[model samples]
Target: MARITHGIACSHIPVLGYAFDHGKEGEAYFKPAFDGFGWTRQFMAEEKPDVVILVYNDHASAFDMKIIPTFAIGCGELYGPADEGFGPRPVPPVEGHADLAWHIAQSLILDEFDMTIINEMEVDHGLTVPLSMMYGHVDKWPTKVIPLAVNVVTYPPPSGNRCWALGEAIARAVESFPEDLKVQVWGTGGMSHQLQGPRAGLINKEWDNRFLDRLVGDTQELRHIPHIEYLRETGSEGIEMVMWLIMRGALGKSTKALHRHYHVPVSNTALGHMVLEPVDGTVPPSPTLEGNSAAAQARIA
Candidate 1:
């Protein structure tokens, strides 16, 4: 059966992509940020997962005001780069795992998590930047991807616990698949920094590090943090950190940190990255899809 081998969480600021695309890695301002992913590249090379479940938010690129899905999964054959105002980044098109994506969508719905299923959509920097950060300048992404877009742009995005629970559901779906595949789920965005308003440039290193600590072992406590606290303390944009919970939730209860890197001033955001693997070397038991759906139906009655 297919299984999620590990989880990854990182910041997906566009400036980091610009730096790598424009050959600014050697520059003083961006070197530290570039250096942060060195270990991740090495980790990917070693683990070599067959597919990646990329979790990120669309920045008004794919879904405009017309429609906003709190949770969307890509079930297309291919996805192209979106031109987010500036031109589209010069990156190869992303290949999607349509079969796995379809299975996940069906399973998640049966698990009582309604999700928007898309067969077509252009991906913005929020998705591509994280790929670039991990794989570097590849002609094509090294592995197939299942894009999971969370609605962080919309006010009152899914709560921390909701995202966490969704991750657990995804883990169950992945394990139930019959294919012999190795998969990794990634959550990208936020390390504290505000990109708008009078307090446009806010970076709280102490808060960011403490959050990382909680992610490693204290997620039970971290999952309870409210959205207002993240917004008020980390900045409006910093609320993006909630998306990280999805990746954390999918990894099961016990995880061993393989590698972690944190750096500041990557444009206006703090960059954080970490690799985590299940310590027990086995998938955890998750709520059965049929059971969950039945429970949901029972609640309505």
Candidate 2:
């Protein structure tokens, strides 16, 4: 039967797409952040998931200040990339998994989560940047995607606990599907960075690293982190990290970090990525950052 096989979490910086489109991925300015994705791409190629349930927030491109859905799922034949000023990034449109998407939507609503069902919505960089980072510049994404857009952009977004519970409901929904499909849930956005105010260029590496540690193992404490703490310690936008909890919750009862990378100052943002597989052992080891302090080493091989 269809089942959640793994979880992937990463920051989705719009500049990553710009660098990729301009062939600046290898340039000195962006190489450190881009290099961190190499192991992820290789890992995805080896154990390519049939579908990816992408959890990300929508930028102004899809929904403006007028209205925002706390949880929205895209159930369309295809989801084209949004045109964020410089035209849509040159990546292939995201093909949707309708059957699974519908099933998930039905399951979530019945489970008491008010999920907005969307038939038409162009995904912004929040969705595309992570795909580009993990898959590289592919003509077409290798797997089908089910977009789960959480409303972290607007004030009073879903709580960390709520997102986590939604993910558990999703796990149940996926398990009920009869098709023998391999699935992966990806939580995109945020390590730690504030885009405005006096702390515009903030990058709390220590707090971000601590977050990565809690994310992989100490989920009980991690999921309980208040929004105010994310704002106070990480940054205003750091609240986006709540989306990762949904991905973590969907990963069954427990998990271990198989591969992880953490880098800083990627366009003034901390870029973090991790691959979590369900683990039967005790809580996974604290992310033993290797190599240098600026770059956390990846161990997928």
**Candidate 2 CA-lDDT value:** 0.85
Model 2: per-residue Cα lDDT over 1-301, one tens digit each? 8888889999998898899999999999899898888988999999989999999999988888887889999999899999999888899999999998998887666666788999999998999999998899898999999999999887898788888877777887787677899999999999899999999988898998887887665356777788899999888899999999999878866788988899888888989999998763222222332233432121110
Per-residue C-alpha lDDT of model 1 across residues 1-301, encoded as one tens digit per residue = 8999989998998998888899998899888888878888988888898999999999998898999899999999999999988888999999999988998888788777889999999998889998998899999899999999999887869999889888888887887788999999999999898988998999999999998887776346777999988988888888788889999888887778888889988887889888888765343444553456664443222
Residue pairs clashing in model 1 are none
Per-model TM against the reference: 0.94, 0.91
Which predicted model would earn the best TM-score? 1
Best by lDDT: 1
Assess the local accuracy of residue 10 in candidate 1 as a C-alpha lDDT between 0 and 100: 89
Task: Give the whole-model CA lDDT for all candidates, comma-separated.
Answer: 0.86, 0.85
Deviation (Å) of 255 in candidate 1: 1.1
Give the range of the ten consecutive residues with the poorest summed lDDT in model 1: 281-290
